[model samples]
Target: MTNVVLFSGFGSHGKDVNEDLFDRCPDLDSAAADILGYSIRDRLRADRGAGPLDSPSNQVAAFVVNAMKYHAHREDGLTPDIVMGRDLGEYNALEAAGVLDFGTGLRLVHLRAELVGNADGAMAAVLGLTPEEIRAVLRSAGLHGLVFTSLNTPYQSVLSGRPSDIARAEEILLRAGAYDVRPIAMGKPFHSPLLAAAAEKFRDALRGTTFGRPRIPVIANCTALPYRQEITAEVLARHMREPVRWHESIRWVADRFPQAVYTAVGDQRLLLKMLRQIFAESIGPGPTGATSRSPVRIPSY
Candidate 1:
């Protein structure tokens, strides 16, 4: 079976892999810590207080930690045929595909988080609602600010926009038989046109960074296809303001590789659940031969 490595976004769980990474690669440890605004160990030990992991520093830290775990797996001689990242996890995916070095990826994430920090919005998952259903509700309710953000599966889609709009939409969706309308633990409305200004600013910041051609087939969240075009600053910036077409991306994988193992590289099974949902929604028993698994948590260094 073909092996594919997937990654989830920030605000997920992490392991104490920093100590070992520092011991083995001090220079890299220092650089990662500097970019993250604290020792990797310190942030991991910070308060578990919730609400929006949108801060540039927190985003950078998450990226660094995930990147470390990915590298640890690589050092152990596991290579992926294709790497996919959801939202912020894209940076780690790029790093894994040899498109960017660890430090470079963290730096780019720092800039992205900074650009996104000024925005004030909320995100929520609208379960048991089709994209068309959600769009119809948005139109009928005249909730202009509410926007469809990420499409996790046919039954699950994330909505982002003004907090009040989201709240009102939640009530409407519930009345319309939505399985659940749960708020995401985030402060900013990401992957929506509301962040178009942030996307423009991020474009400027990303131009100064280096993005190499991927060594492997790196699926893009925007297009749900391989990274065939030039990996430009605009392309990366668009992710901030565009929906993460995760369902399509996963479908692409399933169609291409009938016998494949899908693994999430994080401490949470969030992405794994989404993968299952996508498969569940497929027509006619849906890729019964495909395999899905929990996040592969790499041991500390």
Candidate 2:
């Protein structure tokens, strides 16, 4: 039974989130307090990373959610053969695959917030256009500052740049036949060169942290491949200062694990939805887990 588990970027739907889910588990609850503070559930649910650190609320909350849910699944004796995540979800994959411990992951995310999260950069999604198309438009518009942050789909590109450049890119994209040029939910140039300086410092944190070998392969968004155990920290740090090759990573997994069953955990509906689309486009419609034609099933977590 090949099971590849996935983690979503940003976060999952907050509707079914259990504010007290961690309270039922001692370790998970304690981890929450380590970075989330008292009233962990309530504070996380509130998205007010307004504690002493004041990290980005959305990012910290998503990290907590992914970690909590992964541990819950582990407590139930569920383990996946392959683990992967998009954007911030990479930490979830690392922790799940035994790379970083839970508490350490939390602290790293907090540190990431301090270093990489800034008001100077912004992110937005340009829908109904390919990365190449977006680049062509950028070239035409002379907006060299904007960069492809994440290639979520063949036709969808997440872009990041300065606030002014993002505004200009949006206007130019709208005028250049883009179906929609909307700002990402929590707009920031997350995985773009704009974060290089800060991400370089975050690299020091990654190197300082202890990294264990993964029990299962953990695909990284930065390279769209399994992370090398020896250079795991460097690869993770690069995720902040590089474009996310999400489309390629998903496809690589599907090709590698033909007939593999995909199992999504935590708040992964968005990622799964993108997976379906990715498969539909690359391999044609129908079941979209393994290869285009491989029989696929999404087993319940």
Candidate 3:
């Protein structure tokens, strides 16, 4: 059987990778850079000479996607059977699957970051609480501002809201029998309506961009389904303001690709670690006869 490899590209980390790969593979780098430059220049002309800050997030995504494609093509030789991503990583996965072209995906990513950056609230990771239980606690506490950002696993979830709302939700979860409620280091509440403006801006931007069917399957964060031909920039735009169905996405992957080897292609290995915990029994001893550490770095093929 052909070994299936999964690649979830990096977020901010991809910026550096783009530079590094440019030095190693000039032709690939040039091709990727040309695409990125065209995207930026077009944006500038449309906006009437706005600087990078006006659309920094999309610019970053464009750069990252180019770099990721370069790396994947250079190392893997052929596209993998499946690709997935979480939060910002989803854009990278979309690029890999050929759903969103490099420029468009990058543009969305840029909007996502800026929108997320504008929020002044906080987020936290709550462990040992089922989704039902957490929802019950939120309801009981009357915490109106809180949003569940990630369904990471059966017992682990990430919550986002105003600082006070988050604190209240945390207390309620702990009081309702959660094992741990810890704050995440991230400064903003993502996957919430708090970034509605950003999502709207992205929607406008998407009006001009085009999308094609994917060459490989892409698991979407909002729907947790394979990318369909019907998927439009409008649907992707809404994903910006919707919570990530991470648990469902993972279950989809596990159910569909039982024999595939999963790898998280980003700076943080948290996604891989979570996958191991969720599918501990499914994973077997490798050639080294040991459980693997997550966040496997993609090497040059």
lDDT of 3 by residue, 208-258 (tens): 777778787887888888877676676677687788887788778666655
Per-model TM-score on C-alpha atoms = 0.89, 0.89, 0.76
1 or 2, which is superior by lDDT? 1
Whichever of 1 and 3 has more lDDT, that candidate is: 1
Task: Please report how far candidate 1 places residue 82 from its true position, in Å.
Answer: 0.3
lDDT of 1 at 108: 82
Clashing pairs in 3: 57-110, 58-110, 61-106, 62-106, 75-301
Off by over 4 Å in 2: 11-15, 45-55, 286-301
Q: What is the C-alpha lDDT of each candidate?
A: 0.77, 0.76, 0.64
Superposition error at 193 for model 1 (Å): 1.1
Candidate 2, residue 269: the lDDT equals 62
- The TM-score measured for candidate 3 stands at 0.76
Query: How would you encode candidate 1's per-residue C-alpha lDDT over 1-301 as one tens digit per residue?
Result: 6778888887663543446754655666688866666776565556344433336656776787777677767777777999999888988888888888887888788877877888889999999989998898889889877877898889999999988888899999999889899998766899999899989888887878777888888888888988753765666888899999999998898788866666667644677667767776772234333343322323333
